[model samples]
Target chain A: MQRAKVVGTLWLSSAIEDIRGFKILILKDLSSSKGGYFLAVDTVQAGVGDEVFTVSGSAARQSEATKNSVSDTAIVAIIDRVNEENI
Target chain B: MQRAKVVGTLWLSSAIEDIRGFKILILKDLSSSKGGYFLAVDTVQAGVGDEVFTVSGSAARQSEATKNSVSDTAIVAIIDRVNEENI
Candidate 1:
C-alpha cells in the first residue's frame, strides 16, 4: 500500500460498463522522491484532501464495490496518524 | 502497458512461495513524468539494458509463467521501434 492525498475527482463522460457506479479520484502520491499523481477508485468514501492508503493490482478488485470492475487501484483505508519509529 | 528500460536484476533469497521460479528485474520507468524505478517479474527473458514494455495489475498474471503467483508487474513485450505517426 502507498500513502496518498486525494486531490480531486474525475468525471468520465463514458466509462467501462462495470465501473459506472463508482467514483474515480485523482490522488497525488506523497512518498515518491519526485512528486507525481495518478487515478484510483474511491472505496472508502474519501474526499478531496483526505490522507489515504491505496491498494494496487488485482487486490483492488477484492472490494465489494469494485469486485466486478476492472479497477486496478482503490483507496482501501484512510490514515489516522503515522507513528515515527526510527529504523 | 508502460515502456521501461531494464537496469538491473534483483536476487531474493526469500520470496513468495509460488513465485520462486521467476527472475525479477529492476526497471526504470521511461514514460513517467518524473523518473522512477520499480521491480517486475521478467517473463520474456529480458536482460539489463533492454528496452521493454510492462503490464501491471491482474494483466501481469496472464502470462503462463506468472499465472500461479501474485505478480503485480511483468515485462510483457520488448520495444522494437518507435513509429513517428502524429497522433
Candidate 2:
C-alpha cells in the first residue's frame, strides 16, 4: 500500500464494463519525490483532498471493494493519521 | 497488470515471514517513459531480462502462486509476444 492524496475525480464516458459504478480518482503519491500521480478506483468513498492508502496491480481486483473489477489501482483505506516515527 | 522487464533480483536477509521462499525481483515498466522500477515477487520463475506481466496490490497476495504471502507485487506471467494492433 502507498500513501496518497485524492486530487480529483475521473469521469469516463465509456470504460470497461467491469468497472461500472466505481468512482475513478486521481491520486498524488505522498512519498515520492517525483510527485507521481495515477488513476485509481475508490472503494472507501474517498473525497478530493482526503489522505488515502491505495493498492495497485492485481491486488486491486481482489479487494472486497473492487472484486471482479478490472481495476489495477484501488483506494483501500482512508488514513486518519500518520506517525512517521512508528513506521 | 503491467508489462515490465525483470532487471534483477532482490536478496532480502530479513523480510516478513509470509513472503519467505518467494524470489523478489526488480522490474522496470516497459510502457512508462520515466523508466520506473519496483520490487515484485516471482511466481512464474521469471529470470533476469525476461519480459513478464506483474500483478500489484492485494491481488498480488491472492494468486495461487503467492496465496497466503504478504507480497504486494507478484510476477504472474511471462510474455512471449505482444500484439499491439490487436489491443
Which candidate tops DockQ? 2
Estimate the TM-score for candidate 1.
0.53
Candidates, DockQ: 0.06, 0.08
lDDT of 1 by residue, B25-72 (tens): 999986456669999998777889988766578856765567788888
Report residue B13 deviation for candidate 2 (angstroms).
32
Query: Which pairs of residues collide in candidate 1?
Result: none
Q: Write the per-residue lDDT of candidate 2 for residues A1-87, one digit (tens) a residue.
A: 466789999888777788888899999987444779888988777899988766566656665666688888777666554422100
Interface RMSD of 1: 11.0
lDDT, candidate 1, A18-44, per-residue tens: 445666666777767565666677888
Q: Which lDDT value does model 2 have at B60?
A: 80
Give the range of the ten consecutive residues with the poorest summed lDDT in model 1 chain A: A10-19
CAPRI quality band, candidate 1:
incorrect
